[model samples]
Target chain A: MADVNVSTLSHSPKDPAKGAGKLDDSQGNGGIPAVELIELLFFAYRDFVGDADELLARLGFGRAHHRVVHFVNRHPGMRVADLLAVLKITKQSLGRVLRELVDNGYIDQKAGATDRRERLLYVAPKGEELARQLVTLQTRRFARALNECGPGAREQRESSSLP
Target chain B: MADVNVSTLSHSPKDPAKGAGKLDDSQGNGGIPAVELIELLFFAYRDFVGDADELLARLGFGRAHHRVVHFVNRHPGMRVADLLAVLKITKQSLGRVLRELVDNGYIDQKAGATDRRERLLYVAPKGEELARQLVTLQTRRFARALNECGPGAREQRESSSLP
Candidate 1:
């Protein structure tokens, strides 16, 4: 999911209460909560991706590769075209990354079901294992954060914390 | 933020019942909660930026430009070098965005109090108006979301959602 987005900015006096930590920093303006949004983004994003990257690296891949792998795994036998729509990346951009995954034996690209001209994608057991591992790994961080936010803010936590 | 590092992908799955959204799609090896985390990230990031994008757009800037202005507004009298570090982008990458903010008269740059060569930045009244409009708008959205999630998940919301 790494794409060009400028994130993380230091919060100054505007925030007297910084209890919320890194994630809250980005969302705030002069207020503590607004600024904490940045921190949350950094911390959560970092912590969420931490382990997945390790597993992907061992397979000679990165998060971008994992993202592709995960989506394919999520939608087994999906076409390259569908993938392009979801990923919103140029073929040339995806080609190099896709090649790396395919060459590594993580993906199984077969002819499309209806359109023989299209390439359909699925994760090999190995790819599935990695994608599963990466996704599962990332989910833990989110879960913990959610839990920590406590039972009271469950719904609020889900909706507000994100957008 | 798009450049996900190899080391940072160390994320693990969290318990869904722990308060985060339960995945609605197929359990797919990683299970519903894990998948939900992915969706949550998507939803959160979208809403986070979406809110800001609209508010900033009204002021004649996109997210790229708005980000710089937002940060400066957050940390009044911020030093250029400090801003560069917080943003984690090269001076060149930021130069255009920063220049627009300055040239458009949303920000005021002065000689640093401590260092003559450094530019200390602040949001002009005009900039502050934009920032206030934006930050206030986002804050209200967040506040309302929090109100909806109710007080049941307060701790979790505070810990995971706020950050």
Candidate 2:
């Protein structure tokens, strides 16, 4: 990953919209976003996903496979169209990954009960086990981070930060 | 983008290692991760990078290009080897992206100061401008997320969570 900003980051005001106010205006520009925060997010996310990525690599799969297996596991029997919407990827791309998973027995594709034309996705038993492993690896990191941040941090963060 | 855990997430205790103690163990297993937090990270990162991705697409570029431009703009005269280390991508992959950037006039390649055989990279004025645009789009999202989380949130989170 690239370093977006190359400066020693200092504690800046919480809301730049409120300006520097009565404190030191070392940041100089109130409009400038916090560089440290941006870098932190980049690194954190990289390591978070990197854990599952390593396991996926060992299976001769990529992140695409991880994602397909995860979603299918979560929504069991979700329509392929719905999966496409959630992934924001084209059908052509999804077709490639889905085909690979289905062929490899990680995912099972079925016709919708009511509408035979509608394709539904489900994680096979093997896929479910893989999903559990991925969650375990990721959640371990999540747990360690949360624990270090003190009690109530995760709740406060999820409520404040999540969409 | 597949949902990993398909359960309605609740606020679990801050530290599960203590094993739910005096609290209701609705989570059933104290070891289970807070699915909400995992989902939150997934969606947050997706949208975070999605901002730059949209702009990169318009310019006929991808995340790889965005990364190259951002790094060269930051380090100015970093060696190719260093970039490969930071990116953790293969030489052949870097070669493709670097060649494109150089050919497009977004980046300039020069002989290293002392080691003539070393290929050093520098961002051209055009690339620097593009880097600024990418940063602006990303930081706008970053700042808004931080602001919504209230005062001191950024400082506390960055200090506690960063690598």
Candidate 3:
């Protein structure tokens, strides 16, 4: 899996705006978006997720676990099929993560009221508290970033608008 | 690792705003932040990185590769030590990823002009193109999300302003 050939993958046409090997020195070099903004988003997301990551790490849960508990907490009584669809993972893959969450008491799974075969998921009290704490840490970061961007940040939208 | 005890982890004092197991029926339920926003951020990030993820998957590269090529391309002539610091990974771990990238013509390393013992990193033409494509995909998402948020989005910052 680590040795896949990248060349065989479908490649997009070379973008004229992205001058090959040219350093981006200006905000929008001839209408090309600044590389800084791209880097900023990357770093911002790294830190944004890092908050939950630290907590999850201490609890021996990974990002997959966080995702499972988070969605279950957000949308109570969500069906297992819907979760698999939203997560875009195989049932087998989700099975491992879901089992950990359920066994740990963070999530409770029950048979669908109308359909016994369908599994409905809900966060337990413990799970709900954990999810809220994780969300609070993340939302705080978003709030801070939004505040830092300030009123002038809207200009990015106008400038980077698709041509 | 999945069997670690969550109860043993030092948890923060229960937040009054985060009511105990109360379903979030309203936006900002009594001043508590909406869980929907947290979920939005999660999904938004999932798709945002998914763009680059697909491209990387084809190349037999992973997120670490993306981060390496991205930073090197953004800040050409960055030192290996600096990259290691920014990535916060052990030198041995970086060695595997960096070696593959250099061997594949995606990155070029040269002895530092001032300090011959130091290795300086630069994205090769191939890398520059790949990096640009990935950044373009992600930036487009940011632009679209920012626009969707619009002026009214600023109100969120005002409402959730840090004391």
Candidate 4:
């Protein structure tokens, strides 16, 4: 990977909307979009997911496992096809992770009542517990950040739900 | 990775602070944190970083390369040790990624003026362009999300600067 040169690689044509014309004067006329905001987001996300990463590592699971368990736990009776689409991963890749979760009793798979061929996924009791813990960690971080954002931020957050 | 069973693994003791006492009655007696918020974050981050991942893949690089280039571009003259601390990755791992950036003319490393032993990193012209493009993609997503967050969110965001 170290030997690979990015400059030599072919790039897709730049989006016209994101071109230099959009650069604000504050961005040094360099056509860069909000460098400060970008870096802040990078750091924020790193810490946001870091909490779950630590716990997942302890359980010998990675982000893949966390995603599968989390979604299954959240959307009980989610179809396998729907999970794959939501995750944007290959069926084979999802299968491996799903198999482990099912075999470990972290998730349960039941044939669809309407369509026997389709598998409906649900989180087991243990999976629910782990998922809750992970969500709790993240919610705390978000709560802190939202509170720090100012007085009305939390109220807005509570009033509006994520779609 | 898929063969790993999370349930068979040894469990760490639950944090006492996250016990049932902390559950808001509004969240239901299940003690689950904001599941919707957690899933929203997962999807948001997945798409957020996916844009960069596609570009990096074209260059035969990965997230590690993007992180190195992004930081070096953001903080010109960053010390190697400081970068190591900020990235929280092993020196060897950082070395692999940093070497690629330097070899590919995306980063310039010079000996520190004071110590003459520490290596300070700066982004090259090409690196800046790539960094800006990646930032632009993410900024668009953030802008949309902020707008959807309702009226006063943007104002609060402007007043608060993340360190």
Report each candidate's C-alpha RMSD, comma-separated, in the order given.
Answer: 11.0, 10.8, 12.2, 12.9
Please tell me what DockQ candidate 3 reaches.
Answer: 0.09
Isolated chain A TM-score, each model: 0.68, 0.71, 0.71, 0.69
Residue B152 of model 1, lDDT score: 61
As a whole number from 0 to 100, the lDDT of residue A148 in candidate 1 is 47
Top candidate on TM-score is 4
Please, what are the lDDT tens digits per residue for candidate 3 over residues A8-66?
Answer: 11111232334423323232233435455555445565667777888999989999999
Which order, best to worst by lDDT?
Answer: 3, 2, 4, 1
lDDT of 2 by residue, B86-161 (tens): 5667999999988988998999988866779877787787887888788777766755554534556434433331
True contacts kept of each: 0.10, 0.05, 0.05, 0.10
lDDT per residue for candidate 2 within A1-163, as digits (tens), equals 2122223112111212211112123433344344435445665677678888889999999988988887677667777877776677899999999999999999987887778997777779899888888877777666555453465643444333110
State the C-alpha lDDT per candidate: 0.60, 0.64, 0.65, 0.64
Per candidate, the number of residue pairs that clash is 68, 2, 0, 0
Q: How close is candidate 1 to the true structure, as a TM-score?
A: 0.57
Model 4, global lDDT? 0.64
Error of 2 at B110 (Å): 4.1
Error of 4 at A154 (Å): 17
User: What is the C-alpha DockQ of each candidate?
Assistant: 0.11, 0.11, 0.09, 0.11
By TM-score, the better pick of 2 and 3 is 3
lDDT of 3 by residue, B7-46 (tens): 1111112323344233233322344354545555555656
